[model samples]
Target: MESVSRDLDMPDDSNPLRRLSLEQLRRRTSMKWRTYPHDVLPLWVAEMDVPLAEPVAEAITDAVALGDTGYPAGTAYAEALAEFAHKWWGWGGLAVGRTAIVPDVMLGIVEMLKLVSSPGDPVIVNCPVYPPFYQFVGNLDRPVVEAPLGPDLRIEFAALENAFRSAGRGSARGAALGAARGANRPVYLLCSPHNPTGTVHTAAELTRIAHLAREYGVRVVVDEIHAPIVAAGASFVPFLSVPGAENGLSLMSASKAWNLAGLKAALAIAGPEAADDLARIPEEVSHGPSHVGVIAHTAALRDGGDWLDALLRGLDDNRRLLASLLAEHLPSIGYAPAQGTFLAWLDCRDLGLGSDPAEAFLKRGRVALSSGRAFGTGGEGFVRLNLAASPEVITEAVRRMASAVV
Candidate 1:
């Protein structure tokens, strides 16, 4: 393990993320850095190469010094999240009482689904979505119905309504589900500031979705883990913030925005009308979060705004940097430019690299990016680029990607 500084000195430029070099990044054994060969530049995962924000690091270190690493406890983590939500998103009345701690965002989504649907019940999702949406919902024995994204990479309401209607009309799981319960209802899993593509659903769009979800008896569960990372000029709309959305559930965390994935903590926030359903989650599920993870996440919410602001500036620079890098190295590649998160969904179909373009880039150019096909339908001939690195790394990754095509 590369040692975390006991005392961090804010760098002269004050962008701690930009200070990391290729060699320094390689010294750590995190999955993102160590998964690929030494020669390969790995940008396939969501992990950021940034160092910990001082306040978060200090909180963890303080716990370590005091031997406070016991099983997770307390409402501090959830309360911290509520505070952050209120301050940044202007989300008032976020009752921490209606929230619960979970292992992470994905796991929380899994538990939330259980509250709304039964095994074999139809669950609706938008694709190309985060790949795990399929895996986790399927793991629960629920059938996932895809509502393909529109050509503009935004939600297609017509497609979504079709899926919801089919789900309401019932499917293979309908009879069994209906027989088990008096009536059968489905769950709609939404990804706000959606993964890979980085489209932040507008408040009006979300309100429409909420009305539709209520009309169709579909419970909505939004994965808002990327809520804190929207670009400077863009705005992120929290699902439950919209009118008529009080029955939906939202999952959020500091892990994604703060580069603390390995810490293992997240929150599942419930809308006012959804509190009863949230309370249905088994108490044992709360045990999954790491005690120290809560401490670190709390500190991030309470005291790491300056560091987060700095990292955001660095990431904004990298997003623009990735744009020019693509233009110079592979003008043929199609990119919409991400407005949220450090992810870029690039169109590689024109490159004629077949279904899995990342393979060629890895084998030929020694650059590793996430393959598009795995994200589901409409992802064919595309790649998800990570824009959470230094400008030089982003430049080099694209250069190598262009080289791979030749």
Candidate 2:
């Protein structure tokens, strides 16, 4: 294990401050992976096994040392976050005002739903997506219209338009009546650089979507949690960056990239009309961010870019290793190229482990992964593998997977 100086400004892999043992690492991981048996290696959860940036660690320690673990007070974090977003992702210098903070990205989406939608109002969701997309919309009793994703696991805009038009009718008989009423009643819930399958929609793709949504005046809420993890060559276009997306709201987070999920801090950003709806989300949700989380998140946004770069590089390596392993040893499993994020989509249909390959892998191969069926109907015979662990761990996972299938 690498050591550090415990300095807020230092890198995670800098000169030695201490060393950690394999046993210690396993023990810590076991505490978090409580659902799995002791021998099972967990690659199911999205959290990274790597240590956080030095600044984030130092911030947490300092927060604890100073007894600053009280409830969140002012908007120090929001202001810092605004600068971070403007600098990091090149958002048109949008100021991260006090309204930026939310409990998490999921809550941000939920609040937006509450503010924009009435009961039974239709909301569009692409299939084989994050499971929470279903839960959040369902919990509100909102009627969800499924826009089945393309083979590439990207939103099919044409299909979305068709679904939106048909949703209000509810039945074949009602379809004619609803069409005559001509109400555009659905809002699209887009997962940018989508979870499970990591496909970053092109700028051209986004523009067309914006134009389509603008024509119907349907709201577009984009989950951009994986924006920061985009590799160097690929560009991550914010929905609001497109010409016709003046009303789009983008939900972003440091949690996905910085491993701050435990902190539960994320941002809800919007353009003019969208901002009006999103701004109505209560400050109480903003206050849900704990002091420790604020300290860690602020430190990560303000001073942890180098660490983030290293982490991205590591994920890239792991992605390549996993792909190579699948091709060489587990050829039956297919993986498409991932543009960003640490998750990989594995097509494990040929293994004959039934529809949910992840569960089978866990029980038989001692490798825990996310079941594909959990995403939606199209996700059958697939699984989502989180590649945020050490390279050795990923390689070992492949070995076990290969042996089990053979």
Candidate 2 lDDT tens digits, 1-406: 1221122123235311112223444667433467777677778878777676788999999888898888876666766667776787676645455256777888888877777666787888888889999888999888778889887677777787787656544443454454456543567898998887888888899998887766554678889888888765777777777788877887877888888888877777777656667778776776776668877887888898888877777777777888898899998898976988889999999999899888778777888889999898688999888887766667778877776774
lDDT (Cα) of model 1: 0.86
Error of 1 at 277 (Å): 1.0
C-alpha TM-score for every candidate: 0.94, 0.88
**Native-to-model Cα distance after best TM-score fit, residue 294 in candidate 1, in Å:** 0.3
The true-structure Cα RMSD of candidate 1 reads 4.1
**Candidate 1 lDDT, 1-406, residue by residue in tens:** 0112211222325775666666667898999988988888888899997888989989999999999999998889878877888888888767889999999999999999888778888889899999999999989999999999999888999999889888874443553565466576688999989998999889889999998776666789999999999888888889999998898999988998999999999999889999999999999998999999999999999999898888889888887888888888898889977788889999988888888999999999989999999899888899998888766677778878888997
Runs of candidate 1 with Cα error greater than 4 angstroms are: 1-13, 169-181
Stretches of candidate 2 exceeding 4 Å from the true structure:
1-22, 29-32, 168-185
What's the residue-level lDDT of 352 in candidate 1?
Answer: 80
- Which pairs of residues collide in model 1? none
275 Cα displacement, candidate 1 (Å) = 0.8
